[model samples]
Target: MTATQAKPRQPDLKTSLPGPKTAEIMARDQATLSTSYMRPYPFVPDFGKGVWLTDVDGNTMLDFFAGIAVSTTGHAHPHVVQAVQRQIEKFTHVCLTDYPQEITTSLAERLVKHVERPGEKWRVFFSNSGAEAVEAAVKLARNHTGRQHIISTMGSFHGRTYGAITLTGSKTKYKRGFGPLLPAVSHVPYPNPFRPPLGSTPENCGQAVIDHIESLFVGILPADEVAAIIVEPMQGEGGYIVPPADFLPGLRALCDKHGIMLIFDEVQAGMGRTGKMFSFQHFDVQPDIITSAKGIASGMPLGALLAKESVMTWPVGSHGSTYGGNPVAAAASHATLDLLEGQVKHEGCGDSLMDNAAQVGDFILGELKGMQDEFPFIGDVRGRGLFIGIEFVKPDGSPDGALRDQASMMMFEKGLLNLDCGEAVIRISPPLILTREEAATGLDIMRGVFQELK
Candidate 1:
């Protein structure tokens, strides 16, 4: 009856994971699909309605990842579905760059209004994916500041495009064979408190990174020649790491001192994923530009680059994307933003989905911290709202990626969908509409998996 009193749960699965039907489809996929594609688990989805996903094997599972945190309003919410249908009925593509598109223009206005930054004018540029937004950010920062050098944090994931990949400091696999990436990009350590970079303690890691960049200015890269310092306010693929409290603000002050642009790659952490409208809100900082995509349009393909009006100095015909702001995607984004901003409310636990995320996130984080005492492998539990991670560790205190991999697969088999990030962490970024009951369900499965691991 009460939120905390909800019972532990398990999906009444009809078949084993990757049943006959799913296996056959996977075989076909292996033969036909590109070799570069990676399947974390053998979950072949039939359809998803709300927080539940039914696999091709006819087994139902609670979706904990939300298509890697893209379905902001959950899978196929009626509002987003209806918006897409209406836009499709009228027309689909019309290149928002050249034409005057009403849906995109209005959506841009809505985005500007929700920024919550007073007295600062903003501009929006639409793209089809986060990588494109990063590309645009790179160009805009360079063009606006008349500088070429860029700085990014180690273990940050921007995207896979040339500029984005160059900026990305995560796994080398993402950059494998993609030699000759965009030049003049340098990486500095992100101020992760749990495992502080270069043996620095949590309290000083933020300042340490800032000091390193200051040293860079004096020795290698001059401060005046750097265009931007891009970062993920809270990292995504790099194990869902949250930087120190002073990290973002330190970067902001350094950029201000150097006349360098600060870019926040919010592709995974934006769209109300972190309780607030953006992850940057949690910290006392304002970025010169923001790039977002993952959860923007509630499953539709849409990306956005929002910058201060002064930084958006790129002239017309400077850059273009033919299908960036397609009407259908714009419509879906409009509905998604409406729900996020509470213009269209879902009658659930709280005033808005953002409220639900904060409330539920607090509950889950408390539960996870308790689990750490019981589970020796659970070295760390950190998050903002639903953007959570559970790090596994070996006896020697190093990351236990092997055990983390096993736990993720075990959860999937038990009818709970999840994924691993960083070296040994489970990411718990679910849909915004996830209920307390749903949270309990996943938490129960997580408990079982850790118990088994123990």
Candidate 2:
């Protein structure tokens, strides 16, 4: 059923946030779970359905984070669940390297076709996570170009693996203590319309970034040594920053001028997250390689590195994954594509989901913009579709991370689930199937929280 048709339910707090059961579970988690996992608040979920999550205390809270944007079709979507169930009934794993699976081949074919490059042909490599997809893309780029250096934008998050972390420029915290990182990787500024560098206006920030890269080519790094330039069309973990319209096209032109391959790390922004199959579609520029994962399989462990046919020239055994193409995950991905593209017969499904993302996202952005007028703490509001970020700042215009954290905690107490990114920004990335009513409910709760916090 479509999200709109589904029964609308608001937050139902039966007990205080993180009641007895939740607190007990969290205590156990503290004792057993790894300390590395960051828990902003005590939101121990017992179950989730559609855009609503029920914590162990039986409080139903509106889900705006979507498991950090992993649950593309909402929690336990029937189509995805059924597909996985069917696949498991037959066999679970055969190791893609040793045995062939039609489900894997089918998913690859569908992804290539959906990428919509017109005359260009593309190939796919399966992996288990976004980091693995990035690692695969890096390998392909280096192997194809026979070059040693790679360039990435500052404030971009690729992944946490050794190679992927080396390419990531979002935060030093992600790279701290992991010294002697992979060499030959450099970072440049990404165009931020709200805070442009080099005294650049939004209209010219795109060119400013390109100019910096050009300077790099002439000064320290030679263009010939750079194999690839990896970027997020919409920066995610760094902040949901959307560059100027000309930014991506300018990068494409720069890549064409040199022989460097352009790679888009779409792990957080792809698979209809931004009202498009891929975030780059909004810019009308295509990349040589695209890495996808987070929402591709509706919470299943699946990722893919798609590349132009000519760029995927690595020989056999150069790279392979034992559990990359697990049948259940592939099946879940196929089902996800069907739902995302509106192949299902349900009303308000498929392509309508993307449309909803755009419409509802605009509504939320408008509401927040309106709020900014009353509350100067809101520094900026920017995003495309459902992938959005709201920056908080002090009176002097410096980042107000403490205020942001306080607001988030307050919102959590009020039964809204969201997350923070960058220095002081709240990221709102709901599931693709989120309806306008659901979004409005969450926005209303946020409005109340803002009023209280302000």
> Model 1: what TM-score?
0.97
Using lDDT, give the best candidate's number. 1
Error of 2 at 436 (Å): 0.9
In angstroms, the error of model 2 at 209 is: 0.8
Position 219, candidate 1: lDDT: 90
Q: Estimated TM-score per prediction? A: 0.97, 0.96
Per-residue CA lDDT of model 1 for 31-103, tens digit only, reads 9999999998997999988888888888889988999889999988999999999999999988788997999
Instruction: State the weakest 10-residue window (summed lDDT) of model 2.
Output: 344-353
Kindly list the per-residue Cα lDDT of model 2 for residues 1-454, writing each as its tens digit.
Answer: 5866966678999998779998998889999999877777898898999888999889988889998888988888888899999999999999987777999999999999967577899999999999999999988999999998999989999899999999999888888998889899999998988888788998899899999999999989999999999999999998899999999999999999999999999999999888888899998898999999999999999999999998999998899998997889999999888877778633454356667677778888888888888888999999988998999999999889999999889888888999999899999999877877788788888888778877
lDDT of 1: 0.90
Candidate with best TM-score: 1
